[model samples]
Target: MLTILPPSFTLTDDSLQELLLSSSSSSKSWSAREEACYLIFFSGTLPVLPGSHTASIAGQKEEEEEEEEEAQGDPLSESQLTSLKEGLWCPDCRAALLAVLSIFSPGSLAATTASSTSTSTSTTTGAASAVEARALLLQVSREQWKDRTDGGHVYRKRYDVQSVPTVLKWIGGKEVGRLVDEECADVDKIRALVQG
Candidate 1:
């Protein structure tokens, strides 16, 4: 609906450029090229349609009936969807997830359990939080990626991100501060500088 609508809800190129400029004002860690790619894929004009109560009244009534029918039938579980949404909405969480996705595959994470004795390089290294974060990354779907794009956000594409340093550079190190705790990482210092 938003895609077909006029430039009201979607971001314009000028607005996206301004957003990038403002973001770059903080640190030189983000990749302008990557950001550009993100904008090209997701940015668009907003919807110009006006709301009409009468026009929507019949649709709402039909939707309510459908909802009631769905409620009577087997309802879809939303826990996974909710978790994915939270992870995408939270910058720090998404950054951390990107780092994890860089290292491990979803099948590997799902196959291993607390009781599993098959130890791997990813499972053996770093903090448990890091491991768990990676596990969560495997659970995120492409639909969530679309949602992030709709939110005017960019994510570190697993294949595009070559290494940790590259990922750091891609998002601009300044934004990296959001991923770590104040005590754990120098987020304040990162925020003080602009990135190219």
Candidate 2:
């Protein structure tokens, strides 16, 4: 499981171009398993629409109608709203990733081997369990990937990232599943894909 933590930013074409440039030189040595998984961490925001007109009464009426339709539609539940605010609503992408890692035990192996091989340089004091190892993996991955760039931008032309709190899952560089916008925010969906 190799997670690509792209600089945190909204999706945009320019941002995608930047990502292409920046990641071009990075190592792509990670191997793919039958259960290989890649998590794309990004700021989920709706794509900006091009073209605009002066505000008019007709436009205002349209806006009101849309709002009315939304109101009539199914609204987000309390937990969903809280998840959105906490940035955890993207199908619990982070949690799902962690769950998958826990099942695979790669992070656990890496952490244990590193700690046991070099006690003098080891940051952890005692033997770490798989869960702890997974946490360390996430922490280290974030720290390593976070400061590489300023941030990301929303580029809808390539990745259809429609909102800020989105999580995309890929296998062998092909998108197998995703949680974007207000679709099913269940991590089970991601788990199922990973399990497959």
Candidate 3:
């Protein structure tokens, strides 16, 4: 069994790319331990979407009229909300993976992230819109990706990757160019690695 390790930094396209390149140079495949870590870490950062609820239909005039006639009232239960937050309202791991992979799917990451942010904010006030939520989420996201870097931690670590974008760019080769082009990742370390 492989023990997965958290990324030394955020799992950006650049970092993933760099790992791939390094592995390729070393004659290794994506199945390598570090590569597996990247894959697992990437898989976990995916966003969960809320599902349809009684409140959702309540917003519709037709459903409102129908409900009024029936005197029916059952809002989304707290458990349902919890389940939605888990991204487990339904079991669609493939779809979820696709969503995560969409980060590399030309123009899809921005669109999906935007839509996700908007949806999350719809339940809150204007102060909690996608624009604001993204900023907060991005910050939290970065923190989550941060490795434990106390004094002298860098030398203790064998592979010293610091940023997701940087790693992605280094190992991405040609496939991750979309991420680089989108300005979501960078790859300057390849030169450094080569020079050193």
Candidate 4:
């Protein structure tokens, strides 16, 4: 099976671009495709919305609402207030990280063959998805594509990325595909974009 290692983290687009450029042969952009492709991803997220209860139990949704009201009735604890002030509740962002990590959880890239084949042409959609998550590491220059909170980040402004858990696929130093916000939470979608 062909597999790529997970991405390596970088703080700047120039540094990341440089790493991707040199990632393969000085001549290649580093991809499973004959042409070489690279990926940059961002997983940072803002806090959840006020009306969130996406996972609230059916019967307990009302109870939770009541609890929220009750909690408001009481004075807020210092820690509770602090948590409210600084907490980030974006489960999708966490899920995105977990989905990718889950692909790696079974085994490290070092445990696999150094070189292999790509899954972009697998038999079934499901099979292709399963393999591509791992293929993501091998198919592209393995620079970790995580997001940053710096509003002034280079690519952040350039790409106009407004959500967390974003993924960008680049070939020849140009972006070819992207997944923003919750889309990045699905390993299948992530792999599809990279593998596509």
The candidate scoring highest on TM-score is 4
* TM-score, every prediction: 0.20, 0.31, 0.22, 0.43
For model 4, state the Cα shift of residue 56 in Å: 43
lDDT of 1 at 10: 31
Locate the minimum summed-lDDT window of 10 residues in model 2: 46-55
Candidates' C-alpha lDDT? 0.26, 0.33, 0.27, 0.39
Off by over 4 Å in 3: 1-44, 48-103, 107-156, 169-196
Task: Name the best candidate (by lDDT).
Answer: 4
**Number of backbone-clashing residue pairs for each candidate, in the order shown:** 16, 14, 10, 10
lDDT of 3 by residue, 1-196 (tens): 1111222333344444454444344554433423212222221232212211111112364753454444223323334333433642222322232222222221222333424433222222222121210000111133344437563233123234233322222222221311211122111222122222
Higher TM-score: candidate 2 or 4? 4
The digit string of per-residue lDDT tens for model 2 on 1-196 reads 2222223333333433343334334344222322343334433221111110111123354763454445343323334333433543334443333233222233322343323333233332132222211000111122323333434222333455444334455444456676553322333443343444
Backbone clashes in model 4, listed as residue pairs: 4-137, 4-138, 7-144, 8-143, 8-144, 32-139, 41-145, 42-146, 42-147, 43-147
- RMSD to native, candidate 3: 17.3
Which 10 successive residues of model 1 have the least lDDT summed? 46-55
Candidate 2 colliding pairs, count? 14
lDDT of 4 by residue, 41-127 (tens): 433322221211112333655755665444333223334433432432344444454333323222221112111211223222233
Give every collision pair in model 3: 13-168, 14-167, 14-168, 14-169, 15-167, 15-168, 17-171, 17-172, 18-170, 18-171
